[model samples]
Target: MIRHLVLFKLNDGVVRDDPRVVEGARIFASLGEKIPELRFWECGWNVSDRPIAYDFAINSAVEDAEALRAYVEHPEHQAGVALWREFATWVIADYEF
Candidate 1:
């Protein structure tokens, strides 16, 4: 399986409660049901307030690299990316275990 992880940090002045942020989270939360290639999905706000922590995170798994690619290229996923791009910056990692 391919493990895909992402960390998101809201842009300066963008708070978690902002409508756009909430909607972005909602969009991501819906992906597990919408994307068939996803074998696992978990996303949420970070509980820590530490300066080093990201504001949100995503942990997901796919059957393989091909499924991971399909998930990334999926239109719904693209829509979520477009929305989040407006208010946050993110980092990601993909690995196999």
Candidate 2:
């Protein structure tokens, strides 16, 4: 399986409660149901307030690299990325297990 992880930091002045951010989170939260390639999905706001902490995170698994690619190219996923791109910047890492 491929474990795909992501950390997101909201752009300056963009709070989590902002409607756009909330909607973006909702979009990601719904992906487990929408994408067949997603074998696992967990995402949420970070509880820590430390300066090094990210505002949100995603931990997901897929069957393999092909499935991971499908999930990444999926239209719904692309849409969600577009929305978040407006208010956040993110980092990601993927590994096999």
Query: Please, what are the lDDT tens digits per residue for candidate 2 over residues 38-74?
Result: 9999999999979999999999999999999999999
| Alpha-carbon lDDT of model 1 | 0.98
Q: Residue 26 of model 1: what lDDT?
A: 100
lDDT, residue 19, model 1: 100
Question: What's each prediction's clash count?
Answer: 0, 0
Model 2 whole-model lDDT (C-alpha atoms): 0.98
Q: Over the stretch 65-97, how does candidate 1's per-residue lDDT look in tens digits?
A: 999999999999999999999999999999997
Positional deviation of residue 7's Cα in model 1 after best superposition, in angstroms: 0.2
Per-model TM-score versus the true fold: 0.98, 0.98
